[model samples]
Structure formats: C-alpha cells, structure tokens
Target: MNHLKIRSQFKYVQHKIEAIDKESFRYNYNVIEGDALMNTLEKISYETKFVAGSDGGSICKSSSKYHAIGDIEIKEEDIKVGKEKALGLFKAVEGYLLANPDAYN
Candidate 1:
C-alpha cells in the first residue's frame, strides 16, 4: 500500500483495537487484558504481513515460492485465512484510499 493509504488503514485498525483496549481496562481483568493485548498484537502482526505483500500471488504477483522468511510452510487453511484477511484489508483500505486519497497526512 501507499504511504497515505497505510496511514488510513492504520487508523482504521487502531480505532477498533483501541475500543477493545478500553473495554479491557474497564473490566480490570489482568488475564483478559493480556489476552486482548495479544489479540491486538496479532491483528497488527497480520496487518503487517498483509501490507508487506506476503499474502501470496496477489501481493507478490508471482506464484514461485522461492524466497521465505523462515521454515514456514503454507497449509491450505493458512492460505485461506491469509487470502481472506489480505483481500479484506486491501479492499477496506484501498477502497477508501481510492475515494479519498488524501485521507491521511
């Protein structure tokens, strides 16, 4: 994604995550708060993967699994989730960015 698009996407996820964080704090459940924080981290981690063009053929524009980050293996289930999340986030972000390219500064 482009710079401005990244900013907008960041805001979109950040807002939702902040809401969850607020609830966690209000409940005062240390365990729940930790879990929520980890969930938020997971979201951001997946978001990074989605943004870094690592979701497979679409983002990388190549089918060759030549390079890799680790000994990671891409299973069918993993592929399904990757595609879904990547495509979903892309549509959400790019759609908005297309309509309002200058949304972020």
Candidate 2:
C-alpha cells in the first residue's frame, strides 16, 4: 500500500485496537498493552482484505507479508465476521507477539 493508505489504515486499526486494549486493561490483562500489538494491528489492517475473490482466494495485496507473519494469518473466516473481525485478528497477533518476542527483536 501507498504511504497515505498505510497511514490511514494504521489509524483505523489503532483506534479499534485501543478499544480492545482498554477492555484488557480494565480486566487487568496488562500483557496486552504494547507497541508490538499495535504494530501487528497496523500491519494486518493495512494488509487485509475484508472480502474474498470469486474463486475463494484472498484479495489482500500483502499476501507475502501475510505469509511472513505466519501466526497472524487473516483468513476468509475472520473476514466473514465483518466489523468485529479486526479484534479477533488483533488478539491473535498480540498472542503471537507475546509468545515470540524474539521475532520482533
């Protein structure tokens, strides 16, 4: 994606992820608060396609990045959840980041 598009999508996902982090904080899930989670959320949001193609394949342009992330994979199932799906994907990425800190380091 272009810089503008990436920035816009980052903001969009960041807003949604902040809501999730707020709830996690309220519940004392302090582990959910960090830049790693935010980065993952931004990457997924910028890279994901909310819909699939007619052939049942991803329309997302960052297919290579998606493969690289591995555990943070966004499939058609997540897309089908509509608006709430971003949360699910964010949580998955958070978990992966938490478990694989060296991946980012």
Q: Name the candidate that leads on TM-score.
A: 1
Checking candidate 2 for backbone clashes, the offending pairs are: none
What is the Å distance of residue 35 in model 1 from its true position? 11
lDDT: worst 10-residue window of model 2: 1-10
- How many pairs in model 1 have backbone atoms within 3 A of each other, for residues 3 or more apart or on separate chains, i.e. clashes? 0
lDDT of each structure? Answer: 0.37, 0.37
Tell me how far the alpha carbon of residue 12 in candidate 2 is from the true structure, in angstroms, after superposition: 20
- Which tens-of-lDDT digit does each residue in 6-91 have in candidate 1? 32222223312222233322211111222222232322222122123445522422121212235544456755664565567667
The residue-by-residue lDDT of candidate 2 on 1-105, one tens digit each, is 111111223222221231223332221111132343443332333323234578985333222122224466565554455334445555566567677767667
- Which residue runs does candidate 2 get wrong by more than 4 Å? 1-81
**Candidate 1 positional error at 70, Å:** 8.7
C-alpha TM-score for every candidate = 0.31, 0.25
